[model samples]
Target chain A: MSEDITLSLDDAQALSLDVLQHNGFSRAHAEAITRSVMAAQRDECHSHGLYRLIGCVHTALNGGIDTQTEPEIVDKAPSVVIADARQGCSLLAFEKGSALLVEKAKRTGIAALGITHCFHFSALWPEVEALSSQGVVAIAMTPTHAFVAPAGGQRPLLGTNPIAFSWPRPDGTPYTFDFATSEVARGEIELHRRAGKTIPDHWAMDANGEPTTDPTAALAGAMRTFGGYKGSALSTMIELLAGPLIGEVLGHETQAAGPESTAKPFHGELIIALSPHVFLGQDCDHHLQHAETLFEQILGQGARLPSQRRYEARQRSLCDGVTIPQALYEEIRRLGSR
Target chain B: MSEDITLSLDDAQALSLDVLQHNGFSRAHAEAITRSVMAAQRDECHSHGLYRLIGCVHTALNGGIDTQTEPEIVDKAPSVVIADARQGCSLLAFEKGSALLVEKAKRTGIAALGITHCFHFSALWPEVEALSSQGVVAIAMTPTHAFVAPAGGQRPLLGTNPIAFSWPRPDGTPYTFDFATSEVARGEIELHRRAGKTIPDHWAMDANGEPTTDPTAALAGAMRTFGGYKGSALSTMIELLAGPLIGEVLGHETQAAGPESTAKPFHGELIIALSPHVFLGQDCDHHLQHAETLFEQILGQGARLPSQRRYEARQRSLCDGVTIPQALYEEIRRLGSR
Candidate 1:
């Protein structure tokens, strides 16, 4: 087993940036991608952090990602934005369209961004948080490769599609959370199997549609949706909204949609910004304050709001730094040095 | 035991219209409400059908609803509309604003309606179905009297809030579904309890935060969010979006938010319309065709879409007519006679 080694934020970010730049990314692309990796690391989302650096590098080298292309954004209407990522980074598209989106929402109360030809490979919270900071209530969703089965079916037809939502808070960080429509992550089931622990009943199902407590049996089957049919509907909605609405590669933006082929990631993303400034007018402040009241009530009842732990993790990481597997660090170091 | 009596669609609609009118509703209000109740009955959603008419009449008589007032609609911006239901019927507000909402979405690609001082009851699907029929994608949500607790809390903080979403289809009926974020409906628990069967462990929590299988104990406690923290977040987002964004009754419009009063429903609702005709442009037909492809894939997986059963139920009801309790028919007959 590899031991975890601590790295300061600056060193970790610089190392990832160096590795991307060495892989042929321009300075701008390297920097933008590095920032996202660091944010996820700071929040201790190591799966989306430095651990995925090599995969991004591999994709960049294999033409799955355009190393130097910039996103093209067109303001089609007062409240509509059409963004082409040029088969490049989703962050680049978000970077170009976010400002225009914020401006449009502020002017017209709400705006939508249809992002196509993108490759999104990180947590969606950062983009939503960015919009919230601009006093914009935001929602973001993307369709990925399928890992979840729709409810009542044995076949995996829907992606473990995740959605991120944020509401602006004038006093502090935005209340934000991202969650999959699935009952449990694929990694969670694997962990239980490795540990010889019985899985929960609703977590997964065997091939015959019967719930199983054995983690290994569950793995051989399919993951169940979190609330059965309702969660399945939400997942299907995300696929529909993110895929066809943005004009991506059909409704399921994955290689597994038809006969499988070795293909680069082709995903679509959607971002909606609703501005309280233009929409709520004089009542915006009042609404924000009332939101705080609701938060207090939830806290009083011993319920923590979503994203509280993430924010706390980020704060602690700022003081103590990020930790990653020693072998992974060595691999990144060798790539950066090359 | 009450016998089930079958009522033709025309007779059922006329009976409802007569009762509402005799109770003080104007012709327009009576017509709008009768149309909705009949649709729900036709769809075999008996819980939201004639079952809830008595409560509607009770509220109207107690001054909780304004029988004489018409909905007030103000088009505030190119993509924004503010609607005041004026303590009147929700169907009337929907009737007035849906056309305007459709028009605005077609013009701006996306439009939003913030409806205040409304008394929304029954299903939200009809309004969304109306928008979809106009070739617009729609989402609508409203917070009501609190029934479900936040993820970790013992006290209820959110309504069994429902969200409805629909996508337009050129081929047939638009896909639509509305669902509460709660893990299990109260009626589901009651049935299991009456049957002396143990409830699902994740369905509800006892007053002390322990998961319980006893339905009666769970009823004494609080219902769980569908997917734990994620479902809680969706519920909270709905409350924030529907409550304060509409500026209804000084924010957080439900009665449980403050000292209990005999006030009317006082709910705030949010309706958003997105037009594919404007946003998708040349790819509109292509997107719809691709959507059909995705649907075929899911259906081929032996997974039924969310509303398939509801549509099938409607078709059956149209052929066989609606079945209701004999007592309910007598009550409506007496009210109509008065």
Candidate 2:
């Protein structure tokens, strides 16, 4: 069913926060997580937004994620920090890590944070955009359970392994780009499966390394790399950075039926924060100014900043209300009524 | 064509270096560039190997690339360095930059170097492999002249923007992954053009944003991203980091009519050098040990390390020498004879 009702940005966030609190999240943590999820929806990334609430609640109930624990900074240096998420909700952990990096970068001109043992953090753009809004360039990547295959192989050997980067522009519009390295995200595949639709053949391969268009067969198999060998290599690189290099288990060891399984996904996150002034020096301000002029000159009025479209959609959602599908809304209300 | 040559690796390196020296490169620079180029060829990356020498030499002669200029460290801190290549050959600049990053990382646990004003540096894998061999994790990215278009756009507004990473294993094999964000490299299109063959339709788009298999049309139009939006977004992120973030002109501004043109491509490079022990601490050695073992286990004897194939090819070339196509060999001889 199509949308029958809508919720304003504030109302949606408040409702989400209340739901989390009712389900055992602290008020502060609930607010943080709810805000992040709502922002994703407001920005039109519905796949990672309110749609994930049920899964998140299930995870929390099953002890796969913690809602109350806060991230603790265990080690700090001029340009690096080690954060123990302490099994906290990823929203809280990521926010803490981002803040730590921003502070360290203010002094060192660049900073990095190593985060571990955090739950799924939703989409990466919001956090990176937050950093970029403060005139900092941010790069982030994380590892998860295996869902994608290595190049030329049919076995699922890696997660989607998304990476994101955000940069501040002179016009106050941050350029943000975020995506999973897989040809398509696992969420997309799941959605297709739910919709009873066949996926594109190139998106995945069956157990025997044959391309398949049937969602059932694809799910039983493994997702292929985005661009064959290159994508496979990039996925491996992501694993190295967000896995063993960060003192976490690699993806191959983390693949199991669910997070409740004995196998820890051993998820890891790495964030790099950079200040343009650090390297630009005397040319710092001039560079930004010239960049704006050059960007405008080349793009003219037809071009928009990378994330500007999403941000515009978010603004609209805030000004007006966000529409919720009737089915999803009814489902949420039913749970709340119960 | 493959049977005529049988020189050892040393002889190949020496011969290449002598040719470079005779063509005006300084002795040290010649040896360094020659080794970098031949190493790729020996490793079986003919695209970036000696195949590139003719174009590089042409650029140097036409003043499009500097043959004798030295790259200088313009800015340096405990964990960062900004290098000005002064229009030097990228191989020379990249080597110096990698060395400096390694030196700084030894002290700071991690280091980054920003490079600007350099020519194409051949294959990125070689650079990362060099750093990884020294027990460092390396992330390198660079922007080239515009070739690929943004997703949903027809115009070529960004470079292929290759990103590379390398991680060391205790077994002396390094995992290296290097690739462009474009579905296929411009060089591949160039190869097709030279061979009078039709390009793959998925690889590029014509002016109207429709896919095409014509090499000439693809060259005049834009290359598609490796996998639709994901690759496009990644390329954009790279341009932000390696191009504008580093205070260089964006790809569109660097467009020109080849080596004879007075205009210079605004190539930019960023390298992140990391020490695994920094974050992993006491568990570092064990983690790496287990990682290597698990990697071998997963791949079994059938699979090889990411860089092993290339390294083995180089070893073979060293023992059996390299075979060059007669036409290409004659062209090299003609250039040298000039």
Candidate 3:
């Protein structure tokens, strides 16, 4: 590793919070935003870490997102709740919406929350993992900017539209799975761009629907769905579920087309939370334990839980300081110094 | 085009219903079961058509399933309901559950239902398509017997767990998608078995975790998940969301373990139903129209809806009767004679 410098988690959070605050965010809002970024870094999801600060800062400054706004609950029923994000950062909106859904599930055994008009929430796994850690099963989806092409199409028409689902294991660790429906995400394109590298041809298509390997060409063109038509169909479902169903506009760019649109990114989200206790009656915990045991039995010794690798990376980083590239750290210091 | 037999939609439905009734089902139950099966053939989903009859019949006779039972609504709230299938056919359970969800969605604008202890329901698309036709956005998932191996695992720990989602287009056609989470399903295995053909290596792994192309070996082993880890993660989500979270026992062979286990062969389902008007206000229909227009504009003349090919095939089958394999047809006739 390069011997430039390293920051503790606390120091990283403080530096990030200062940058957001200097960029005109309230202290509370800045802390919330910084905490989420730090959490991603701690969990080893570097793509969503400090590397994304510039984009988020630009979004806040360009009026594409509001830093101080809060989400408001618009409607509530036995098992459903609707929230208007009111131009807030999606981290705030998602945290609030998830809490409400958990509360509702506690009462009704299951709950669904629809959130509209929010900015992008970095990395979906953390949100679902938070719910799962609270002893609830959670599923979430959000519509995004159009970057992926539908099956058999040449042009981009659907967003990556990532989905996340998680359930708690008896050991308190959550089995979390989150992914974009595209063959590759825009973040990976940015990574390749930074490295001056080419991508696999199947990852994207040029304007005429021919395969392309150049990262620049792929970014200008369209990303393919993960597994052809199946992934394309899933992206369409996310659009329907997160857009029109949540009263948000379809198509990510169209949602942000006008100045009158909320500073929020105009994306929508749906979260479902379920309580196992209601289903398993007196044997909920035992059932989960048995399920995990069976999973281990089938997997044997060498097997790993889905999130275990990331979790171990996080533990190691906590003991030894996290390593950040000199360029990325210098960029963050420059932003804070500004 | 086959010269053997030609049946209109009505005639096909009548014959199927007659066959079920002759096998001792009540007329209403027979009609429901027949309608589901024939609709699969009508929609060009031949894999789920009359070919599933033998399995269903055997299940009924082996005390493995109850053919005469009816679904019971176990719990109801404004936005959610739970239904117990009472070992009943999933055809009845799914239809009843979907109807209830749609009804609740009409009232509350969004609704969800959990269905448990149900028999196998053939062809998930037809149900979602029906909901979409009624202008309700729908998503459905079901957990079944273990047929898929988890990512990096030697043994199968998950069912194919097909998921379906649908939305209505302004042009009066429903955009529907349905697929099993496996790289290939058991139906494909059976198809290759009937043809005395070798399977693809990537489609399955033997019990020892080695890829194989023999149909019999594939059956003895496990189907691989679609796109490896992504599909396996989805299968895990389905198990947690549709099975364990909904009061059904998870894992394969739970039924064989004992009556105390809630694990039926084909068990849990979770369905979500939504009315666009819930969020879109008065412009809901307009939004759908706009979506259709946007999709058309993006695709121009060459783009096709996801299910358009299947629908076209069904129309062609109506005009020119569907072909049936001579050997399979002879086998069916012999069974009937017995």
Candidate 4:
């Protein structure tokens, strides 16, 4: 078989939607999820792109997601919105709730959205970037299944919690960043194990709470958080804010509630939006220009900004389409066939 | 001189207040700043405690802060409050705006406070911890003078921007964490230099953008942010949110506005407050219990929480007072003399 194949962006969306619908997801759920999948593909985020379809299908068939139910949007407070996912994937809930969230932020200067009873399986950048496109600063975070450990401990007590932030620019794409709090992704360690290579000492600790370079020992033990204790603190903050504050499951509970070794974890997400118009009032333009100057200095100093590569890939994908492994394409086509 | 002297908490507050008032600060500003100094001393955060008094006095006299002008509070929107500090210290601005910020959060579910044109010298934990004491989950961040570089760059373009988070518990002190985005404080490297020791490899970079372990070289170059690119991204987020979003100066601008080689930096601070009552409604108590369970698990695994050591020090300080250097006490007293 050929190693690779090329598909236009439209075809990628169609394939994802078909695979999701064939696995019993409703059209609304499938479309919402397909939008995120398309975005990941366009940005060249391979792990979150076509590769995620298999996990979505597996979770829909075996992980107990309520795909048939629609998310219920509620105006919880003057500046708060809640989208109860009713145990479904979070994309649809975010889609349903984010409009009201943007309006409330515009009206009240700041607002929050809580997506409860959700199964989250995508990177958070798409949601934050979408909010920024509407001219507001957005911060989004969620707690995943416990796979990483707190600093100074070997056991898995913390999630690879991710936090995303986006700032709307006067022109062009928003300044955006989304990253996992873990030192490295779980797949990185797995790849090293498969290659029979030693993992970096900072990546994980052995079962005895000692830092180890062996990939196998790291896999048996736990992943370490980025930036040592500072990253650990941030991961904990996400667990508390996205988990308890919004009446959602913690990382360990999310892991236990789903199928054994399930790729999709039942969790919650919290997104906060702030309007620059409200904060700066008439001087919003002046402040935004100052931001441009800061960006100029950063680039002038030969430093790359976050999401720069993603944006470049997005431009390339828009012009030339995306390429994926032929084996993955066949596997997805097989899953989609009724 | 004796190496150390012990003072009761009241004496610490009185000394701080006296020093500020003697150095041309209004009683209002002095009192507000003293509370934070007292809290730092009580928590055994010696660096931010009485030791900061000299710098405060120096900045008040030479750093161009408007000591006589009071902060003007504005209710910009339903959920936004701004305290234009009139070029004064941020403590007074934060003190004036916090009550309204807490009220707005409770009423609307989420709220933000912006302190503009202020000289900030205290740790952010005090502000977030104060909000948590008022039964709200709080997050605070501020941009300091540009002394650190982005992860991939060599020259300084970003601040050692600090972020602090706090969650209220049903009883006792709140769960709080405050840390700079930098790998380590600039003072850490300076201390290594004074002790004639090499700094850590991750602490900073030389002028050529290469990693350096020599303390003098690191001091002459740029401090590295914690966690490489992720920390750099977070620092940038702070620069945008607290700087431009609030219509205030960025890190380099803050440094330029203050006296050359001055210890204090003129900047802006942003604090966000969220209410559990609004999100979980009547089920707030149930969710808080879940948070306690998470805390229990973290403690059970012998992994310490972020503020555990500070709380322990707080207890000891409350029982046995606080210890400081006799030389520093004499210096402060001399500065306060008529």
* Model 1 lDDT at residue B48: 81
> DockQ, in order, for the candidates?
0.68, 0.41, 0.41, 0.89
Per-residue lDDT of A160-207 in model 3, one digit per residue for the tens? Answer: 889888888887567888889998778798789789998999999877
Order of models, best TM-score first: 4, 1, 2, 3
Docking class of 3: acceptable
Best TM-score among the predictions, by candidate number: 4
Q: For candidate 4, list the clashing residue pairs, or say none.
A: none
| Winner on DockQ (1 vs 4) | 4
How many angstroms is residue B2 displaced in model 4 relative to the true structure, after the best TM-score fit? 5.2
Instruction: Quote model 4's TM-score for chain B.
Output: 0.96
Across B277-330, the per-residue lDDT of candidate 3 in tens digits comes to 665668787777766654674457366677778888878877875555555445
Q: Model 2 clash pairs?
A: none
lDDT (Cα atoms) of all candidates against the true structure:
0.82, 0.75, 0.74, 0.90
**lDDT per residue as tens, model 1, A1-338:** 66999999998988998998999888888887888888899998887799778878877766677889888998877788988888887887888888998888888888899888887787889889988998889999887776677887886667777899999887887899888778877778988999999998888887666789998888777787777888888888888888887676543447421224457677888888888766678888987877777778788998898988888999999999999989999988887764
Worst 10 residues of 2 chain B by lDDT: B297-306
Per-residue lDDT tens digits for candidate 2, residues A1-338, read 36566788877776787677778888767877887889888987888777767766766776666678878875555577777777766677777677768776665566778788777658888888888888788988886677788775667877888888887887766768887888888878888989999899999988776899987888888888787777777777777777777787677666432555754434678788888877677787777775565345325525455576788888888788787787887665554423
Residue-level error in angstroms, candidate 1, position B329:
1.1
Give the higher-lDDT candidate: 1 or 2.
1
lDDT of 4 by residue, B114-188 (tens): 999898889999899999998899999998888899878889888899999999999888999999999998888
Winner by DockQ:
4
